[model samples]
Target: MTSQTDGTAPAEEFMDKVFGDYVGANAIFMAAIGDRLGLFKDLAAAGPATSVELAERTRLAERYLREWLDGMAAAGYLTFDANGGRYAMPADHVPVLAEESGTMFMGAAFFDYSTKFGESFHALLEAFRSGEGVRQELYGQEAAEAIERFTAPWFEHQLVPVWLPLMPEVRTTLEVGARVCDVGCGQGRALIKLAQAFPHCELVGLDRYEPAIQAATENARQAGVGDRVRFEMHDGAAGLPGPFDVITTFDVLHDSADPAGLLRAIHDGLKPSGRYVCVDINCADRSQDNVGPMGTVLYGLSLAYCLPVSLARGGAGLGTCGLPEGRLRAMALEAGFAEVRRLPVDDPFNNVYELSL
Candidate 1:
């Protein structure tokens, strides 16, 4: 290989990275297939089995199962007994794959990357050329469901116990009785969690996407918070129906059509003592500072979904890592928020900001 920039060795190293990424992508697609088919769960529950046994257990075709098993074994996701003709799910992998409610569960992420993001490749390419961007509605239900599953553990396990406690005043208000709204509340998971935690509080969820709103309504009902929580299809950038004691935007601002307008609406929607909890990607203002594994993932997602979705709505197009603490504070101040405080929530994936009128 001839060197284009520095040397042939660097070119070879770059190609190695590209090949590694290709392998990783193939592995993720396989993982998504396994997740969708419940193969991992069955393997974990039924113990080691051959392709034919797994086929009988799952009622899937034998040849397909055989190929999938071989692929998984090669990827180190399963242990293959060549002599016994069986494949086993590793005990350590069970939590990350089969246990949906566990904190380590990452099965949904594979689906998100493989189906939700991968399916949008062509649209993203068009977006790159035209600068018009892909619309949110284009991704549809799969994206919503994938996102819900990806974040469900956080809402279920961490929201009430770990995250809310970081904001004592807001938690106390919820403990009593307070009108709360969650903007961009996909499937209403956070509100459902809040309703379950604080029976006295009135909770409402709002999202621009109709499918998400419908899903949220059904999900809230299923969670038995139907009477307590409400789901509405409304854009927060327009105006919030509020005077809410507490309002939250979880991983929403950067993907919003008008983040500044939404912030202003949130500020106006709140009572004088109301608190706005903004949960966004944890990142630095400068690109150079964000050069690790998390940053790489965030940037790739931005290119695929977040940035384009916002641009399609004629938004500011603040990509995934666009809203660091400094930018958020400045935007909040401009929106007439009197105070903006970064909470002491120790989440690597998200930053918690408390804004008050």
Candidate 2:
């Protein structure tokens, strides 16, 4: 009976955890709605306003804003001034949700991701049963564009100043006007940054998605680097035209249908002295080693999005968090890279690697 009680306790405890997660997810959904509707930003700017005041300021319905404000207050995202009958976003929370360009801005990104996940849930369910998933097209353009926006803060703020400078040689190569290609360059944020930073370097952004390429091309034009920065609709596996000086793929290799083939193609296209820089999720080779909320979230994303897209292409699906250093090193070596060295970077979610032939 004592042993039965022990087993039963664990089951009950697990169920408690599951219920807590459901609550957390609902809160996130409400937060995302608030973000999408600009309720949080408005409240933050107005400083302890009633739901009616917030609605008046934002031109939204008072009834909906009232309900949303109450939900946020209960979720602890907003503090309720019970005496004054008002609500407010805590000062500490403002930067996280409102400051899109700041490093601390994560709420908007997570909101975009969660909303997209919710939209894709049905397609994901079908993919689980059939082993053939919906493509990125099914998520629609908004979701596709959200990915670029979500990652823009880091790319704009860190890529040029912090990450690129880690490899002095690569930095020097780009400074000297070399041909550079960004494979799977969604929305061309990174490439645009690179183009602005190194005007001498010729830049090419490639993605299989035409919508992304179109966006990227327009983005470069808006950034005033369109003369030197170009976008191409091409699969990474098909490879770029040869003798390129530097090739970089930010969080893209694992998303490939044929990552190994893509690597080989990258190697074949590069000049003898050229280098390949890959940025991907920071993860462990074993499941047991990944022990935390971040790991759980990444694995959930793998199941919902990353794994499905690659599998849908009838290719080796190295899901999100699947490319640990050891596996990546092995694949890089097999693809004719003589060396694979990890660069020192402080990013919590990603690791950078420099591969050379």
Which candidate number has the best lDDT? 1
TM-score of each: 0.96, 0.95
Give the runs in model 1 whose Cα sits over 4 Å from its true position: 1-6
- Over 231-271, each residue of candidate 2 has an lDDT whose tens digit, in order, gives 99999798687679999999889989999999999999899
Model 1 worst lDDT run, 10 consecutive residues = 109-118
lDDT tens per residue, model 1, 147-221: 888888888788888888889999999999999999999889899989999999999999988888898899889
How does candidate 2 score on lDDT? 0.86
| Residue 123 C-alpha lDDT in model 2 | 83
